[model samples]
Target: MESQAAFNYQQQVEEIRLAMGCDFVALALVQSEERHFQIRWEFASGNLSQRFRRIVLHSGKGVAGIVFKTGKPIFVPDAHQYYKKEDMYNYPILIAEELESFAAIPLFKYNRVKGILLAGCRKQKCMSIEKFELLQSLVTPTFGPYYSEEVTGI
Candidate 1:
């Protein structure tokens, strides 16, 4: 049943990618058993390679890990401008997946981060703030277990 659920989750992610017309989309989920706070890219769409499937991310390590820890969305229009090449290795999924621009959004279940959803392009500056906002709008009210925590603006 667990495996089936994971499979279903992957399918949903693919559906989201197609619906959004995104260049690429991937999801990284934490294991339910909590044996370790390890994260892995469980699903991908529009992939150039399958290398990301094997990479495991620790908390506060990469894009997903940072979003997972902070419970905030991360939008990078140009990875080269925002992150150094030396720091790229920390986000093995990005390097392995060959992503140059991306956004990482936290998925919440019961007010806690349960996973991360990453949408990206292989070219620099391919994503924009408008697209990011639209993506956020699209994912907020629905998209399964992922929910943004309510924030009260000052």
Candidate 2:
């Protein structure tokens, strides 16, 4: 896609966050050839800190990285209960974004994970499976070059 058109990434993420009433929404994208596939949060909404923007994740380090490596979706409700605080920092996006419950879905292009779209809530257990499913449905089959694997029959 043209870089100009792609600049709408932040706008689209914010729209999704508002529509879902999520506390935070962010998009993580793999850097082009210059960065050798390193991933970073490219856009965010309702962010608590800028720490996430400085983080450059490898292919399997954190949630977005893991999703990119495995080409799968990840959901964590009640992050404090699901992950210890010490370990939680590994996911800088979660920490800087102040996400308590979150889901990360891979955005695919040509059957490869190109980026991740994340939605989160600051309140524990605020993101239900139904909402997660809905979010998945909403982005599937569309969303720039990213398509949900489940809907793509992959």
Candidate 3:
């Protein structure tokens, strides 16, 4: 059952990457409580290598971490401009993927961020505001088992 779910997620990630015309797309999911809710890049499409699997992040650490911690979406038109060369190590995913531009959104569950969805390109300024906005609209109310936005009571 778990494998099936992962397969479905992989397909969805690939579809999103294709739809967004990105060079790479990935999903970072929160591990179970046993792992202290650590986040890991579980699925990816159009990746340059398998380095992303080795990355495990705590909230507020990397790109996934920051988005997970803040529960807010982020768009970087130029990774180099947004992050200094000396500070590139802070965003391992971007470095691993060699992404020049990217955007990521928090995936919610039970009003809490449980995952992250990221889309990126290798060319500088390729991820424009319009592209980021389109990615936002694609997620809408939900993305797989997680909600794209936090759910609140009236």
Q: What's the CA RMSD for each of the models?
A: 3.5, 2.5, 2.5
Pairwise lDDT winner, candidates 1 and 2? 2
Model 2: which ten-residue window has the lowest total lDDT? Answer: 1-10
Candidate scoring better on lDDT of 2 and 3 = 3
- Residue-wise C-alpha lDDT for candidate 2, range 1-154, written one tens digit per residue: 4444454677778888888889998888888767888999988888887777898998998988899999989888889988888898788887777788999899877777889988999889988898789779867533765678734554
Structural similarity to truth (TM-score) of each candidate: 0.85, 0.88, 0.91
Report, for every candidate in turn, its global Cα lDDT versus the true structure. 0.79, 0.83, 0.89
Q: What is the lDDT of residue 129 in candidate 1?
A: 86
Residue 52 CA displacement from its true place in model 3, Å: 0.6
Judge candidate 1 against the unseen true structure and give its global Cα lDDT, from 0 to 1.
Answer: 0.79
Candidate 2 displacement at residue 98 in angstroms? 1.6
Which number leads on TM-score? 3
Q: In terms of TM-score, how similar is model 3 to the real structure?
A: 0.91
Q: For residues 41-140, what per-residue lDDT tens digits would candidate 3 score against the true structure? A: 9999999999999999998999999999899999999888889999999899989999999999998877889889999999999999998987887775
Clashing pairs in 2: none
Local distance difference test, candidate 2 = 0.83
Q: Sorted on TM-score, highest at the top, how do the candidates line up?
A: 3, 2, 1
